[model samples]
Target: MDTYTTTIAVASIVTSGITISIGVIGPALSEGRSVATALSSLAQQPDASTTITRTLFVGLAMIESLAIYCFVVSMILIFANPFWNHAIA
Candidate 1:
């Protein structure tokens, strides 16, 4: 490959790796903390288990969306990168 193509490939790979790594870390930590907090609240109020679980699931889904977005971005970078076209041209 030419220098331009090589550079683009390397950059895309590195950027995607970094994006996925950092993105997953944040959400993982957030989800862990959220679950811990919810568990503590549930322990304190067993009567509210249903409400707490529903809210926790919703919140977890929202938090997980961030990781999903990062995965999509990384997939685009590695597979359907626009720079590939530019490099080819």
Candidate 2:
């Protein structure tokens, strides 16, 4: 409710938004590249489709985890904001 709290809230929201965007964009691009590469490899080597598919799944999982983490951080900013309490106190 005070100026400090207002500033913290605004900063937290901005930072969380930026972090979410960066986190999502990077992983999205990485996932897309991974899939494209995997598909290309699979096309070139039909016999290695199983291995490529397995690796592609692993890469996708890792990339997705980053986005999930960002989502958690954004949710924390919007709902369970620690900075608000810290600023008030």
Candidate 3:
């Protein structure tokens, strides 16, 4: 393959790798920390368990969206990259 093609391929691979690592690791850490906090709160105030649990779910969803966004961006970069056409031409 031409240099342009090789370069694009290498770039895409690197981008995907970085995306996966950051996307997975960051969310995992955030979710773990959030759960730990929620559990601690629930233990301290058992009466507020319902509210705490509800809020925890919402926060977790929001945090997870970041990972989802990262996944989408990586997929776009790998499969539907705007630069691919330019490089090929």
Candidate 4:
């Protein structure tokens, strides 16, 4: 209700929005590009399909983790925010 709470509330909302947008967009774009490249490579080399497929899965998982981390951080900021106590006082 006070300035402190107002500031924290606004900041948390903005941060969460930015975090989710960047987190989702970056991974989405990366995954799309990775898939495109992998498909192109597979089309060029049918014999290496198995190896390429395995590597693509691993890379996708790794890329996905980045987005997951961002989601976690944003959730923390929005739900379990450390600054909430200060703002409440």
The model with the greatest TM-score is 1
Per residue, candidate 4 scores C-alpha lDDT tens digits across 5-79 of: 989988998999999998999999999999999999999999999999999999999999999999999999998
Q: What is each predicted model's overall lDDT from 0 to 1?
A: 0.98, 0.89, 0.93, 0.95
The better-scoring model by TM-score among 2 and 3 is 3
Off by over 4 Å in 1: none
User: What is the TM-score of each predicted model, taking all chains together?
Assistant: 0.97, 0.88, 0.93, 0.92
* Residue pairs clashing, model 3: none
Give the poorly placed runs of model 3, Cα more than 4 Å off.
none
Per-residue accuracy of model 3 over 1-89 as CA lDDT, tens digit each = 49998899889989998998889899999999999999999999999999999999999999999999999999998999999888887
Model 4: per-residue Cα lDDT at residue 33: 100
Q: Which scores greater on TM-score, model 3 or model 4? A: 3
Candidate 2 Cα errors over 4 Å, as ranges = none
What's the ranking of the predictions by TM-score, best on top? 1, 3, 4, 2
The candidate maximizing lDDT is 1
As a whole number from 0 to 100, the lDDT of residue 5 in candidate 3 is 89
Whole-model lDDT for model 1 versus the true structure?
0.98
